[model samples]
Target chain A: MSRQDAPPIYLDHAATTPVDPEVFATMKPYFTEHYGNPASIHTVGQKAIIAVDEAREQVADFLGCKTGEIIFTSGATESNNFVLKGVLAAAKIQKPHIITSTIEHPCILDTCQHLEKRGVEVTYLPVDKEGVLNTKSVQEAIKENTVLVTIIYANNEIGTIQPIAEIGEIIKKANQERKNKIIFHTDAVQAIQYLDCNVKKLGVDLLSLSGHKFYGPKGVGVLFVKEGTLIEKIQHGGHQEYNKRAGTLNVPGIVGLGKATELTSKNRVADSKKQQKLRDLLINSILKNIPDSHLNGSNKHRLPNNANIRFDKIEGESIMLHLDFEGIAVSTGSACTSGTLEPSHVLLAIGVAKEQAHGSIRFTLGKDTSEADIKKVLEVLPPIVKKLRQMSPLK
Target chain B: MDHFRDPHNMGSIKDPDGVGEVGNPSCGDIMKLYIKVGKNEAGKEKISDISFETMGCAAAIATSSMITDMALGKTLAEAIEITNQNIAEKLDGLPPTKMHCSNLAADALKKAIADYKSKNK
Candidate 1:
């Protein structure tokens, strides 16, 4: 039960994790037996409503917030859009400014870009070589007209954990000193699995998460909007989700999210410890055994289950294909942008050379990863790197 | 895997008649093709030798090897007829997304041939 006993080692948990069986079991009833519109005014509808209310409470309990604070969306992308656009639109301030780090997920960055064209001023703060954001840079970037500050809790490609608490504290102090209520948001989609997600503990007024990233069903995510956080409705529909988002609920997915959050809150401590050991072993062995290979991000401030590595004079796509031939699955970077053949923006942001960025590969461990998986990777990687190097033009 | 592991004609041809390099670093692929021109018994220009050095994915390397194998011993005119599809077919067809690699190989070969022709003229 420690590792998935399979041919292809699933080492891309940062992209998505397989749904837990227990979470699936909890979702089955909502799809079939308890199938009813939560908005209907009947007994079956009431039954569905009870299930939804319970799920809301579960997610709220996991995030340590009130039940009404959690709003379900199609996925994290929509949740992020809602927060960024909704806050700015509702603010109604002239030329409202926003602050975010350069290493944010595309949803945040793209949304910010779109908002900028509409008289919004946005500042993208750069991270250090290790992909860690400087708190002072964020403080300096906050203008008097800055309406919101959104930063990703952990980078998807590099697995760098930004100083979320420190940034939050700075924002809190800035709001008090300037008497400007600049809302703070963190896209915790990558952090929900192994990091502490309590809203109060992180001091984030708005947080975003996707179900699929944490062993839940896809197409469902939650955005934690703190009480009294003024936000306008992005989607117009009947009175569902308090009219903030208007659509019939994905009941099964919501149930799955609730269960996934509950399980992650309970098991993350032990899971992180186990994955950290495997991850360190993988990183150390690859660094020690392979020549001219380097780790991509911070050694200390990174996710427990992630490793981004680069080998000199070798293409990452080649390594991915060779590893695929050996029945081991990995990624060069984010799956969302895999087919584009562009070197990772995160790598470039961290000051990695373009040639080195092309050679970067990401290996993320999960709860099911085992000792045998690590052994297989160690045994398989060197020969593949060697073969690629022998064929490489630079080598 | 076969062509990628043991490419047909790899490495640079020393003191070659012409060289062609295709692809950019941002695309994560760069291919350099070198060729030697010679006169055949039929008094026609033929490619005496062809080799490639590729920094790319499996498909890119495979297509480079395949193009070199197809171009060697062929007349300049015949080599000029080679297309991305030909190189892909020679390798049992690459994925749709990877067809660009075959394009890079064919383009590099044509550039090398053009270089040889212009230099000789």
Candidate 2:
């Protein structure tokens, strides 16, 4: 019965996608007999070391970068911290400044906030009504002391895909005029699988990706450091990840991550089309049934799988619960801070009024989402919204 | 909540004296409670039957189910007094953030019982 209550529909891919079976299958052997410490020079260690090197090569190939540019970390959160800490530590005497956007992940936000306490000035560029930071905003925010600019490639909350190429160009032009050019970074945790995330074309000096965000295992991530980028290492320990990050390699997690990268590269186009259709269906149907609703981002520029809707007269959490009863799984942005009833910061960043922010719902499609699942969602959601609006105290 | 592991009083009730539908749709958690309230010949206001349906997180669903179990066969007045805190305590204390879910069940119960009393009187 409990299993029955666990609805088969899973539409919350942005929170964390399930590991592909193929990736898990590729990673299984390393858990036991094939396991060895990558650091040790012994045959056993060399075996693991060889696997690690091969995984790094695979990861680099997937990202269209050289092997040396990659640094494995716990996840994107750690990678963001590493980049911020590394640059801050190296540029101690310069009274460095950093620029980021209001829509950045908390990893970037909190890290910058921490840096502010430690004497670093941070310039927060604001996004437009659609949650997009224009290149002009970025260019205007850069200052003489600005050492770096960290922005999200795609917003996790509202699914706003930033104009990275344009933003990248603006920063490059800004850097050309300065002696200590500002480094460019983007947290593309949500862009790796869905969007074609090529670091060179994007011209980002540093980028962070959580493996789990792209259907790899949790606790494993990649920090893409462009060659010649000056960044400092925050953690001091055994020189793993080229002395850039410390502690023994998470060989098993790295293997899973590498496998996941390969699988995503292989299945990205086909799987994206599959999820996109479902996303469009959900968006269209919800708008049709719930008339007083609005789409949150530029339809053309958003992720294929992301469909954010604001149903007037209803709250997101209440809608979430109502749909949850109908055996559907969706999100309202940022599962990282789910327990908090506060509306999403990304929604607020995009200039969504607090009322509309409370009413928003994010339906992110994934590899396993089916048409039937979406049909079930459509079947049960409209009535729930109607009923909830009738009960809302705010109304 | 217990329902996640072993849900209690889950079947359809034969008859009901009061029913509770509480949970904020804006918050994405809801519970519907059906109660059978009447005197079993002894003039006691016993909740003769009870069942519930909930839409929310596992914790919320379980809390709703637990509250129904606690209120089944209970006196109507006694059932109305069950606080959200009491329902949460029954679950060995829910996660701090989900405390409102317990309140949802209790609040819905109060509404249902009051509805019942108003209609019968």
Candidate 3:
């Protein structure tokens, strides 16, 4: 388990993934040789436009949507904001309300907070102990002026997959009952790589995904806006992305995204099966070997690659650093605020005690992950957890 | 990181003269420090024994271990005078973000000394 034995065994894929080699090769030409602004009308620009168009088609095909429905943005944050704010601003009513979960990404929660200051009412629905949103709660929270309902398809920290299609059906039935059009949105950034993302079957009006999560380059994402959905332009600039989003195209990143999307879509089933086997092995071995440790999130209906574990009487950051010294990479379920680290809001919302939240560690697998990597982690982890626990106050 | 591997003055001291418990709210870490008092030949009070238990990041545990090692066998005044900077320096300087761990260690030692003084008085 020494650093010299092998390269670092990375398990933080949920944060961001390395670009696939094929994706990099596809994007290489666009960066150097075919550099041109899509807005420009010349041949080089037309070439760039052609690439962007084909990328759009690739992404659209992956999502089972038409090309015109996909709008490229900087990333999921921008896409989430555009959908939340755009729909609110364009609503016919004087005051618009939004419904989102308590465990959404900060982009959605922070954006809701920002809009609330400007005369919008937001309802943050709570999740069950297992981090699953109850459809009955969503059904009861709908109001006449509720213009948008945005929820994450899979939680980043816990890896719990929300019932998107069921929630969609509930929203559709509510709309039919009240005759009020409430748009459904899901941040599918974590789901696009592994889950089936048929927009029609999911019954979502808008879906957001980031390129980096799917082995594509950073700074590129797609916002699938169902046709005829009323959304105002958030950025006021050039007339791109059907006048909904304004920015010059990122030709190379988009090309990379296209290839990444295509590769992931084709290999998802086999890759997920492999990752699931490794994930379960790591989980079972750790739980059996390590004392006083339990898994976070639901055992079933979770992402194939995620394993969030909590060790009693030990802090996750210490475990992460100890693993880092062993040339293994993992993530802690805590974020810094005002120069002090705080447990993740997602963990807190799921009824994990504040102190227990400090002990949460997340290990997310990826396409490149192998069984040997999982074995290496299992070998290094038990001793680290034991050592940290020996020094802990609770123990 | 090495200090984390072989921490000094860790665990609890039975029948301690003074004990201080501290918590870092943001990180949700708890640290407890114990001190046993003794009088030297010069008739000055000294930290006869010191140990710590911490539940936190590497820096927090290291600082707790560092502070106890720094305080053991030192005069009560000297032990209480050890600052967060000294603890951080002993650990080869912690990340700026983890500086609070050193602060928590210093505060725990200071409170232990204060508890000893008040109880004796």
Candidate 4:
């Protein structure tokens, strides 16, 4: 029987998509057959270097940037920290002012918040009720000391796609008046499939991507450091990543990320259309079956693969656990804070009531997700919600 | 099904004066224990009955069943010591993660029994 006919349907792609079979096939040879370190000067090492560069070139082509721009790191979290710390060390940016949104991934939001504790000034811009981020508000939040404006390309919890291109332009216009040009950065951990990520076109100076967010292996990510951008070294070890990122290379993971990026570039348009259709199917059925259900983010200005819903008078973890028992995987909000009972900050940022935020669930579709799987989820979920509510205090 | 559905004595307690309520909002599980205790016509205290209402997984429901059965007729002191480890050991051991819920539920029951003892004294 085909694996597609299996019972448990995975709906939590945002948490982590299964490694694509295509990516695995491409990465398999590197672990054993060509295990030499890329940094060594020997011929075997030179061969590994060529393989790494080829993958880098593939990622660069996919991102529409120079091959020299992509710096491999552990994941998006490190990339984000690198960018934030890098600005602090730059010769031009002294006691830098950083601007970020309140609803960014914890890696971005927490990093910026922590930086504030160390005497670095930070302004957290607000989003609209639909979790909508506006460039105008971000522009207004910038100050004379503003050093870097980093925003998430898409929110992992609510799936709201920020206006990154517009914000990029705002930074560009502002740079003309200031001698110290403000660097633009984005945590595109959730935008691998949808965002129009032409670094030159988007006018961004730095970008962060995690392999696990796409259908690749974990523990590997890419940071697009625009050539000549003034960012400091966060880690001081070997001369890896052109002295930008330190430590030994994760060769297999880097290869997988490159293949995954190549696959995304090739199939994003078709895959997004497929996921959008499946997302709507599940969403429409859920709204019809569950009472007091509402979309958490903008219906149109969100990830095509993501459907976040708030079901009043119910708990998200209960729903997730019940769904998990039924062989369907899902999420309450960001995986970063899914352990807590407190409402998601993203939901709260968008003006969702505290009770509604506790009831939210994020269902993210992926490359292999199908219409059949969506229909099966619709069949299994309503009764679980009804049964849980029937026994709950809010009922 | 709302009341622990103990096919043997589900919600059959008469005027359950002793009760317990403990819940975890994050995990979305709540267990409520109902116990009856009063002095007989001859002027001696006895636990007349016990029951429960729990909202959780099948394992949780089963755990609730085991708890009510264990608490039904015991002296307040004896019932108060019935712990999560006891419940798991009784039920052939719950999966590791569910062990926490079992402990929380047992603690709630013991606290209820203690509360009852305090009121009587």
Candidate 5:
């Protein structure tokens, strides 16, 4: 069959996911019918307040935190900025410091750069060739002035799962020896659907997650701030969110996020198992059928749904466009796609050469992925790669 | 996007009169231009055929295809005068970020003309 007649396949779930139907249904009523300002004390407004509270409880339940600890924000970017700027703004020490990994999302890295301009010291720790951070590096980077440690739980590009719990334990021990407590934060936006994220188990004082990452609505996120963690509000306005975040609630988006979180908690284990199998099938098939193709991240410690593959001679953007023409959606680590003229920082951090990084493509599965999707990819991808390689001059 | 999907005049000409390569693999764009030179009715040297092989983005491939179409059958002097803007205009304009891809395409054509001149000299 011609590619124009084929059904489109979505393999870029790491970028964003479509809202779950159940989550959408749960959010529908709040948009028009139950629409009221949560700040209002009237019966109509009180309903919105109740819905928002329930969402907080649902998110809190999933993360094993108290309901009061959940603070709703616009999304993970805001949540991440809130933690970095908020904590440092409230720090009592002179010249506060933060330790973060080099492979963190741009939200974290950019926030750290913005903070650095204002005299806050930041140490960006490096990762291994497999994109795994050594817990000892985190321990050694902590100093007397270190006030916070933030890291990404799972990378968006390569899908390498960092050792967050081990790093958290190292911070826990470090905090015991210091007079000033060092707060631990993690950007868990990409890990919420496939990993264990209970705050207590992870030893995290602050955590950030976005709704759209896990089959929920966009423009809504949660920042888990432990009771005793010191953080000043970044957005100053009203008395909402216990004066921690000062904005009217997004009732429908919160409802969707809550429903999505509840469903993820219920089906995470099964979903991970299914995606891992399909992901392995896709990765193994491509490696077997295509010559000079290499996997980008750690095979054992990577996310269940992610497969980043690099071709020897062809550029990633060309391959991505070819696959897109074949009715498949995917992403690339190449500078051409990002408009930045620089390759993915995560891939570069893992020591992938610039040319190899330009040749890498990322395929992330989701709860809806099946064996048929893997088969379709297997059928279409080999030919596409071969064609692009034929047109490539690198060889 | 159309040019990217089905590029015109792809691949190299065997024993071509001129060959020009520009950009680097590490920069995420490398275009190699091949040209066949022949005499026109007026006995002036003109391009008989042109083709390209590129390893880059959709913009890069599309620009390479567009430049080949724009330069084919033109005299080397006319081909060298085809600017990056002309290629982008023929392709209905590229994104600001992708303008550099068109530049690389123009540079490759210029390099090919230079190679042809050096060979005949």
Candidate 6:
């Protein structure tokens, strides 16, 4: 069939999800009818402030936290930066230390790298073969000057869910014996959709999540800061977000995020069950049909919707482009796709060879993904792999 | 893009007169060129057939296919003159990041010609 005649199948949900219609409808009125600065004292502004407060309450309810603890920012990138830099800046010691894993998103890793140049000591703990962090490593890395322990709840590329609650428990136990209590932060951008995010249960002092990853409008996110966790403001400006994040609020995006959070709280169980079934089917079928193909990351502890597979001898960009021609969208860890000279750091940290990392593809299912879509991918992918393998010289 | 979708002159030739392989898997691209050298009507050594086996991205595979098509049935002297710029131009253009792919393609062809000359000498 011609490319124009083929139906487009979207399976790259880990990158971003389309905004839910209900969330969009909830946000519509705030954009036009209730448009006002929340900082103003006029009635129009009060309307905006009420909406923002309601949104904050909704987010707090979803996370099982207090409304005052939730500080909204631009997105998870800002929220991550705020937690890392803010906490370090507020440290009382001459040389503060941080403990984080190697699989965090670039925002967190780059921020840590930048802080290292300015005299902050950072211990980058490595993960196991399945991209799972060892809590023992975290406990070993902490020192008298250690101020924060930030880790990703679920990895972006491999979708391996880390043991955040266990790590949090370890920190809590260690804090009881020290004069300086260590703060635990988690970048839960990918975990908000599938896993439990109760702040009390997870024992996290701070958590960051983005709206765009969970079918909400972009440019809005939340940073849950437990009361009494010392963190100075990163962006200095007028008093906003309890003087933690200083900027005029994005009211519409907040409303959308609130609606999205409410919907997720209601439908998470059913969504998880459905997507897990489809994800397993996709993984099993691909592994069975393709030769020399294997799954990356931990199969048992991964996100319900993510499947990262590597095919021997064939490059992932070629497979991805071939799939694109068939009107299917997926992602790859190959350096060619990322416009960089190195492959995925997450894969590398998990012990995947550089050449093998070049052959990995990521398929992330979403709410709208269907059995038909999975079938279409299964029907098209084997032949593409075969053709590319025939043309490859890696055998 | 068309060449990437339906690559031409793919696969290696059996018992070819010369072979040239370039690139490494560490850099995420490897191209091997196979050439068959024969005499033309003018009694000059010419490339009668050529094919490539490449393991890389769309740009890498597409450039490999394009170079094979450009060098086939050309005199040895003509084939040796195929520069990376000419190969990229023949494929319309390549992204700046993928220009190295075209360079690999041209280098593979030149190496094949050199291999042929060394054997004939």
True contacts kept of each: 0.53, 0.10, 0.66, 0.10, 0.73, 0.74
Q: List runs of model 2 lying over 4 Å from the truth.
A: A1-7, A334-341, B1-94, B98-121
Off by over 4 Å in 4: A1-7, A91-94, A334-339, B1-69, B80-121
What is the C-alpha local distance difference test score of each model? Answer: 0.89, 0.80, 0.89, 0.80, 0.92, 0.93
Model 6 Cα shift for residue B31 (angstroms)? 0.7
Q: Which candidate wins on DockQ?
A: 6
Q: Could you tell me which residue pairs clash in candidate 2?
A: A86-A232, A317-B27, A317-B28, A318-B25, A318-B26, A318-B27, A318-B28, A321-B28, B17-B37
lDDT of 1 at A335: 22
lDDT score of model 1?
0.89
Q: Give the TM-score of candidate 5.
A: 0.98
- Given the true complex, what DockQ would model 3 score? 0.58
Cα lDDT tens digits, model 4, B12-80, are: 345567777777444455566777885556655555687766554444556677887787776666677
Evaluate model 4 with DockQ and give the value.
0.21
Better of 1 and 4 by TM-score: 1
In candidate 1, which residue ranges exceed 4 Å CA deviation?
A1-6, A334-341, B1-6, B88-99, B117-121
For residues A202-309, could you state the per-residue lDDT of candidate 1 as single tens digits?
Answer: 999999999999999999999999999978889997788977789999999999999999999889999999999999999999999999999999999999999999
Candidates sorted by DockQ, descending order?
6, 5, 3, 1, 4, 2
Candidate 5 at residue B20, lDDT?
Answer: 95
Better of 2 and 3 by TM-score: 3
lDDT of 5 at A76: 98
DockQ: the better of candidates 4 and 6: 6
Q: Could you report the Cα RMSD, in angstroms, for every candidate shown?
A: 2.9, 5.7, 2.0, 4.2, 1.4, 1.4
Candidate 5 per-residue C-alpha lDDT over A1-395 given as tens digits, one digit per residue, 9 for 90 to 100? 24677667899999999999999999999989999999999999999999999999999999999999999999999999999999998999999999999999999999899999999999999999999999888988989999999989999988989888888889888888889999999999999999999999999999999999999999999999999899999999999998999999999999999999999999999999999999999999999999999999899889999999999878898898888878888998788867877988988899988888889999999999879888988998999888788778877
C-alpha TM-score for every candidate: 0.94, 0.80, 0.96, 0.86, 0.98, 0.97
Q: Please tell me which model should have the higher TM-score, number 2 or number 6.
A: 6
